[model samples]
Target: MKRFFAKKEITAILFIGILFTLSFFNWRSAYATMKEHTVSYLASAGNKWENLSSFIMDVDNTIHEQVYQKYYYIEGYGYIQELLGKKEINNFEVVKAKDGTLHYTYFTSGPNQVTSLVERMERLKKAATKVGSEVIYVMTPDKYVTGVTEFDKGIPYNYANETADNFLQELEKKEIDTIDFRKLMKEEKEFAPDSFYVSDHHWKVETAFWAFTKFVEVLEDNYGLVFPNKGEYTNLENYNQIVYEDSYIGSMGRKEGKLYSKVEDFTFIYPKFETNFYYYAQNGSRDVKAEGRFEQSLAFTSLLSGKGNIYDATNDKYFTYMNGNPGFVEVNNFNEPDAPKVLFIKDSLMVPVASFFALGCSKVYMIDPRYYSGNIEEVIDEYQFDYIFVSYTPQNLTEEFFPFYKE
Candidate 1:
């Protein structure tokens, strides 16, 4: 009789606890989504009568998205992964390397098809030639470094390097001048594990600066061009290094959270020398213009201004370069009148790379095809750039990047 009474009492306490927890979540989700839900509900009122089940699902999804403390919930999931000793997170969408770096990857056995992609590049070449500008396919290195990065058993490899090799070979056959940073980085003894962030897919700003130095070398040797301040532009010591520890949670970090992977430190590198720049960017109706000094003009330092422990999704610190790949952005270096005028059709990897132009370029225009609403060919003709660089990482060898040249 005594044991039966104790069991009943324990069951009653657990039941009440579960009910209270459910009620708390229900109230939060309701309060959080009340306005949006009401608007959406009215928008779908007619559809609700026609396809009642479908309308019900829309409500369900809205509720699902509005879970209170969503970030904490994902963090809890990351903690669970740590407790389980799982190297792969969210079913292999992200994998942890031996060094604890997060990588975006999917299962692949061999190289990806790039014949059509090469054709797109060939078209880009034609466009550049039509505008009297020389073009080069600048291949940015993927985050997954060969030999240096390793995954545990059962972790899926993305085979991005092999894909890159095939794509470059195709470009070479077409006589397309190319710069493969993967090969360049491999040859550099200093391009070791430390050159990358531990928890982000993007390379460090220092690495991007190193790339800028090498790119200048290419121009001087191949294009018969000489930089005005060659010594000042290439040297890393001339740049101001601002570092904030425990400051960043990268794209992958936001997915896996701090428990599965540690929060990464962010570093900002800018010219220590006095300089003047005029920058303008446009994305839809959002237009931003900055002038006077590199730090104030080119760099969007507002993203780094954090209000405490909580990270805002809108403020992705990595995009502090040129305000994060707007549809169109132009930079005019008031100091470098004789500097080469260059244009870049590039991805996010080239955002920081374009900023390096502030050191010497007279004019620089960048267009991200994914966002730009203007015609690429028109931009090329009007600008008449001295050099046009079409740069994309190996992983981005897809229909998305080659959207410029379509029948």
Candidate 2:
């Protein structure tokens, strides 16, 4: 019995050894094939591995902070494999001409971007003027340009201010009407330390109010439209509530590679007016309820909503603005007939600013070129706007504006 047991043990050991040797050779060849496939797949997918890898790394860090380090590393390896196998491109930054102004040796695409935007403005202006509508370019300030407290000194490039200056000069040369909000803010010293949110890129609602006031002034001066003073407009500060209190990770914070820090809590402010309001985007027209007062929607809620068909009937609500497609958005105000029909060509930075226009304009048609593939000229012709405003952040201005213009 002992001899039989010994023979069985030796046989088992030999079988296990042979299996290990076969697996070793197989793994090497398999690993080589995997490497080749990964490279080929990445090349076919336009080499988006960097962005995919970064996103995976972020997810890993988030999970790592929650649990074990080994889980994070293992998940990261899986993410790498998935990324290499992907057939589609995810996130990408738009490229622009490198020859432009330099701020602290960090050059910006200010010249090309501004020039191209001005040219688009010229086309838009001619189209609007042909329809007997006025064109007003509303240039919004970036957090860095506006000198928001948290971003006062950290920005590597003074590109925001440079872009603003170049844009203004180019517009002036073309005799285009513009609303320079940055200069107005600077002249008024609106950059009170806490005026901007600590973590987010957007200014506090108070800043928007101030901007609205300036916008009102522009309307009065340029179009001879008179808006009532602050006393006449309802202030909803008392009704303002904190809808969400958790720390937010904003675009800038993510781009700056500082995800660990807590972002400021975003507060949603509503006017003391009634909440009975409805809105819809359809057939190139935005229609709203005629009777009820406009209730301001939560800022963050809008961000949570993703993109879809703009003409769908399901989008006929104020909250729909938050999640609707980024292309052309038409919002109608049923309050007054004489209210201006505005064409707001802007970036994501203009989302919060749309609220101010809601109060002023009878209808606001917003178009984001990043998502819109159709001819911008045709959209302008179809909308028949009374006023046109172009607003964007410095980063987008430097990167995206040129491509849209070139197209």
Segments in model 2 whose C-alpha atoms lie over 4 Å from true places: 1-113, 145-155, 226-231, 234-246, 254-259, 275-277, 281-321, 402-407
Among residues 3 or more apart in sequence or in different chains, the pairs in candidate 1 whose N, CA or C atoms overlap within 3 Å are none
Instruction: Tell me the TM-score of each prediction against the true structure.
Output: 0.86, 0.61
**For model 1, the run of ten residues with the poorest summed lDDT:** 306-315
Model 1 agreement with the true structure over 1-407: per-residue lDDT tens digits = 99999999999999999889977886677665666655666676355567656556767776765666777888999999989988888789999889888888998887789989999889878877987898889999888878888999999988888888999999999999999887788888545667777777778888888888988887789876667798998888999999977888877888868888887788899899888999999997689999988989999888777753434556778788898889898999999988889888899888887898657889889889889888887788788898998988888888888887774
Candidate with best TM-score: 1
lDDT of 2: 0.53
lDDT of 2 by residue, 324-407 (tens): 335655555555446667777777556656765566566777777766656777766777876777777554555454334344
Locate the minimum summed-lDDT window of 10 residues in model 2.
94-103
